[model samples]
Target: MRSVYVFPGQGSQHKGMGAGLFEKFPELVAQADDVLGYSVEELCLRDPDRVLSQTRYTQPALYVVNSLTYLDRTTERGELPAAVAGHSLGEYCALFAAGAFDFATGLRLVAKRGELMSRAPKGAMAAVVNLDEERVREILTGLPFRNVDIANINARTQCILSGEYDELHDPRLRAAYTEAGARFVPLNVSAAFHSRCMTDVQQEFALHLAGFDLAELTLPVVANYTARPYPTKGYADHLAHQISGSVRWYESMSWLIAQGHRDFQEIGPGNVLTKLTAQILKDPLPVETAPAPQPAPAAVRARPRTELVFMYGGQGTQYHQMGRGLYDTDPVFRDAMDRCDAAHRATAGTSLLAAVHDDTRRGRPFDDILTSHAALYSIGYSLTEMLRAAGIHPDAVLGHSLGEYVAATAAGALSFEDGLRLVTRQARLLQERCPDGGMLSVLDSPDLYRSRRDLFGDIALAAVNYDRNFVVSGAGTRLAALQQALDAEGVITVRLPVRHAFHSALLDPIRPDFLALTRDVTVTTPRLPVHSSMLAGRLGTRHGWDEYLWDVIRRPVRFDELMASEFTAPGRHFFVDLSASGSFANFLKHGYAPALRGAPAINQFGNNSGTVRALRDELRRLAGV
Candidate 1:
């Protein structure tokens, strides 16, 4: 069987993805660092700066890791594959591996491409699932809307639509796609990519492409623009055109499968293209006319003993505009958030509305205790409402430190109004009374921390996430020194974007005032089970919201212990990460459970709110509801 190496694009990148690949090829990593004018390894291994999610840095880092993986795999096999292909940004790696361009030249082009693309005008992209590209095009052509374009033909049933953000989110257009038997989901991207909106960047990138010397491919590497092997000449034009041209990923894979290449090897971080290949191969084109669009006939019961778990995260997960995708696209989410904003105003807290939805404040750091704390509660509560509105009611909910506040509200331990008031008031107390401090994420066992106490002696254990993952809390001023010390010992460390050292003695100053505020609060038994990270187990007692909320703030987060106690059959649980960045979901991914797929939540990456629709569809499909 012939084999083809495929690389994934953006949306595949994740923190801690390139753990050892950089060390395997130190020389290449060093060269990459030099060309990129930054430590690519540092960016990959521990992006303390949190800039990896940005398009400009994401591309270069992905290219290096993908290149390293390709090089490593081929070296072990002592041979190259028959052909190579990549999706979107991954195509650069395909070309580089095929000897079309040398390392530095390819890196330069990718870096420039990322920077240009990052600057593309604000627009949107949506994945239209369950519809063929032809049908999507036919629908778009018939719609009264204009400027929309297909960005990626991912599979026969999954194509990405891009254009002006407003036009893409238009209800008439979405209804057309849905009426035609498809799921229209607006992605989390901030710009119109691979559409005419990228024309400006494409022209600039063409100039950048002309500056580099290119070479003919030694191995067949299919192009994203034409979906075939590159011609001997004008490689620059083909590379540049894909900027504004739709990626022919499905067709490219089909051509390979047509040649009997069934053994496909995914060379990069994610299984995105791999999954697309399986889908494309599963439903090879000329699809029998899809039966007319059908509504789910009847609501069905969930599997016996099955559950929906709402998992929440604390700080370091908040970002400006985290839930803007849903706020713009989903009315239920928007309405909940509007109520949250009204609460924010009534409570005299910071403008929660402007902090998250205003485009002007998009890139600014939202790590302050005032903004992050309230934002976390707002997004978490509103997201839960959105999920529950879609019939995905949580059977159990878990919270990590500040997450417990929102979780309590979600679990009915406290009312929404009370939860919002308490969250905002607590933020005020922490910001005003608690001295500045920070937290550190160490990707090693707690045993490491115990063994290296001399170095981490000043820091307090904040949370034990999983087996090898733990966090430490310390003074804000000492955070830098602690990170440097860990670096000297070759320990992986990430300074979580938090200003207050939560769950530590540093917050002792605010305890008196904090408890005073919650003392008069009323509570009720949760309708569903509520797990507490501080308690390290299921919440107990029928009341005492004051003590519970205060203990959540002042105690260490024993996340793993709580999870371990609950660990059972994956089929019995659905762990949904409701944090802005999917922190809880990322923490649980360490377990590699099949149920993780069912807990669809937003992330810092592509199509943030798209996952919400994915969750609804999965629940509807599985439960027939």
Candidate 2:
């Protein structure tokens, strides 16, 4: 179970949002006033002049209140969520939590963003409900409404449109909406947002973003334009494009849900996002209303008989100083690290642990494809041992891509030494032979890309992670060209963090070498159930161990199908991600059936001691210990 903190955007503001928070964080409030050249406390607490309704005043006021609200909550709770997201104006709040910049810097930028938007020509914006994106686009594309563009995708069936004020006021357009059985309500905003109407404003905002320096976010912040978590770099470019891009609220929420975040807390004033989230996720009970005859509060459901499944993550998942806390706090983990270090030194003549445990705490050039694989194998295998020592046993095991080695070792199908040997050989061959390429997580169905293969020259569909999410791998230039084309068509894509384009034709040359490395190691029958992601089925007596090892390099990973099979089985299941960062839990949660929505899926070492404590508390509650 993971928690996501969401912040509301501009339309959620009210006359008295920061009433209590203003006095609680006076220093922050003062700083906000000094930065914006106005009294944020007065605008939020009283709004005596009624000027807070204006876009310029509204953005700064809401930013201050939202920031104060977050500070107040975290101060009292003494913990941070696993990730953060924000609506249009609220994205600044999310970035603040990521530590991309300071409070003053965020306030300064928000003020400018608001000021520029306020200066745009007056335009009309309206919400269209009970209609999907395709239908809305069809309506706006035909006849005199061609200039209208979608401003916000609030939910699967809800969207907002922005266009010239005069064109939107036509009675015929309103009649067309009524005839289509869609409810249309005009918004009070004076300027059109997230549309071509703000092109000039967007250009100016880009200049503002350039002047400020933004550090990489500590926690992932889902972007409104991309509907994916922000990448390791390029914060400035994303924010610049976001000025005139549609606010992908529903998609962003769904992405978070797919990552296994079941608990979401609305951080700012007003329950707009809270109510909207309930609508998007389809919570049966209305979140905004309380009826007089409301039923009793839902009881905490008792845990059913549960089974645990261990999933290992593969390459490109490692980062600087990963497992730092495990090496310090857990002696078992440290001992395993020492053993891996010795093995690595024996083979490579240098200790890989020093690079994995880089004291600089910053990314360097040496954190490349070769070292990343070594660290992943060492840290992942050691963490599994620690879990076994703690009496946490797995009923089954599987791995994604490079994680198969750890999975095989944990399932007793192979020895740790042999697994390390295979990993080392694979890494060396890949580093020495494979050409440079990239992988992009295309946020659409495989059919979407497969149907238009001609458009994606040289790019191959590597893996289908979910119904609408797939990965495309190919040479760097071709992949970049594909990404640009997708962006132009309003399709979201994320560049995966990996050195080589894997699960594609580029790895074919290294297959024979990898097979030779595997032949030297002895194979045995599994002591526990071991699932094969490549086969998208259980590794029954049908396939030989050597065959799966060869297929690991030659075949693509069918993670989507593998999850569907696991989640649909007879008993309650828990997917535990044994990776350095524990980020794979989100993908497991994403593929889970709706019936298993609240199951206890755990991610080891996400926050070191915090994750350990959460796993303990959940297991005890389930066992009734």
Candidate 3:
């Protein structure tokens, strides 16, 4: 079951919207205050200055409050979505979720964005209720209102029109919309957003965006400009364009529901997105008032028992002290790690355990391509063994990116020694042949190719994790430049920590070598059903396993299409993450229905033994064990 967190833009702000959250996340509030040079908590809770209604204050306050609400929710559950999206100002929060930038960076950007926007020429916007976009567009283009634009397509029938005050309030145009079965109500916005009137602001904002550092997206964030995900390469450009581009709220909401996100939580002041989402999906998301902030103990929910779908995590999910406690406390897990280390010692030339858990060489293991992949695979494989030894087994298995080797091995398609050799061999060959390059997880989708045809030098889409979640790979310098451009515009991106770019042209030099090495590796049909990220479907025997292994190196990971197909089938499935971090769990939540969501990672809180016990208890409750 996938869940979506939708944030509202300017129009949704209220006098006392963030009352419950300000006290809950005082640190974040303080950070926001520091960035804005004022007390955001006071503005949100008291609004004594009525500044919350102004565009400059509204944008930053909503952004901070929305971010805190999101942090609070995750603090309660420790899970993020498969993808994230927001309305105009709220997009910054979505970008934050995607790991494009840190919280303080987002606050500063949003504050600046608001300040710039508030300086725009004054205009008026009105909500034209019960009118479709096509009709509204025709009205705007054909008459004295030609200068007017459909600023926001909020729902199937609700369109927000923006232009000069006199034109928007013209008696004839308002009469025309009303006669056409629409209720036109004037809006209190200080200036036109997502309209041509903001052209200068867009350009100025782009200039401001050029200074910020945008990491690639960690989660998929649906961008308002394209009614899809923001691309990894052009973060600031899109946000800049968004100043004069219509907010495709209705289309964005429709696309998510069509992609299988059924549950939604509005993480801001009002239920604007929630209400609009209901209109788009033609079904209401259950609504409730904000609960007073309180201490939330670790929670475990039973019932709705389902078959397990174990997902071995890919790269970018590794961290220091990842499996440290398991190594010390669980003999089964430790033995598997030891065996993997000994087996791959010749090729790796280092201790796998030390690479992952050693405190001394903290950053080296993450930076070295061979070490990182080896650590990810060994930890995942060992965890799988430990889970099985504890009488926990999955009905189906899947892997993201390089995690496929572990999935295949666990499913009996390859032996442990062979899988390790295959992973190590591929890593070594790439390190030998490929120059240092980078992979950036962006928030845009494949539609980015057609919608925004701007060229990103040497960058290719590496993975389409979900509708909005995508990765681009290219040379290190070019990738860095792309990230900077995006960061300036407030588009979020995450630079995947790796020595060389995988699944990009950078890896082409080693393809032949990789294929040749894997040619002699043994292949067998899986003992359990296995899904392929490269194929975007179930692994089939029609092609030799050798071909699949090589294809994994060449093709983009189609995790979005693969998981979509899995959930379209009828039974409940728990997508449990067997990686170092539970980051993939958040991705799964945004892609599948809420019922399919599960833990991000065991021991995410660093209380390894307690977390393991809780996981076992939850599994037993789920399986009726």
Error of 3 at 63 (Å): 56
The C-alpha local distance difference test score for the whole of candidate 1 amounts to 0.78
Give lDDT tens digits, candidate 2, residues 1-625.
5578899998888888887888887788789889987788888888999998899999988888888888888898888888899999999999998898899999999999999999999898989998876577656533344236688888878899887787677787777776888999988888888875776677678767879888877988988865767764545756766777678787778767766567889999889888888877763211112111111111222434566777787755677777777688888888988888888878766777887777675554333776777788887788788788888877778777778878889988888888887787787898899898878888887777756867776676667677677887889889888899999999999886677888777877786777677779887766766766765545642234665776654456677656644344333566667776564565545654453422222232345756766776676566577
Over the stretch 257-325, how does candidate 3's per-residue lDDT look in tens digits?
A: 767777988888878777778777884222112211111111223434576878887777777778888
Give the distance in Å from residue 611's predicted Cα in candidate 2 to where it truly belongs: 1.4
lDDT string for model 1 (551-586, tens) is: 787667878656644432346566778888877767
Summing lDDT over every window of 10 consecutive residues in candidate 1, give the lowest-scoring window: 289-298
- What's the TM-score of every candidate structure? 0.51, 0.50, 0.51
Inter-residue clash pairs, candidate 2 = 259-586
How far out, in Å, is residue 42 in model 3? 75
Question: What lDDT, from 0 to 1, does candidate 3 have?
Answer: 0.75
Evaluate all candidate structures by whole-model CA lDDT and list the values in order: 0.78, 0.74, 0.75
lDDT against true structure, model 2: 0.74
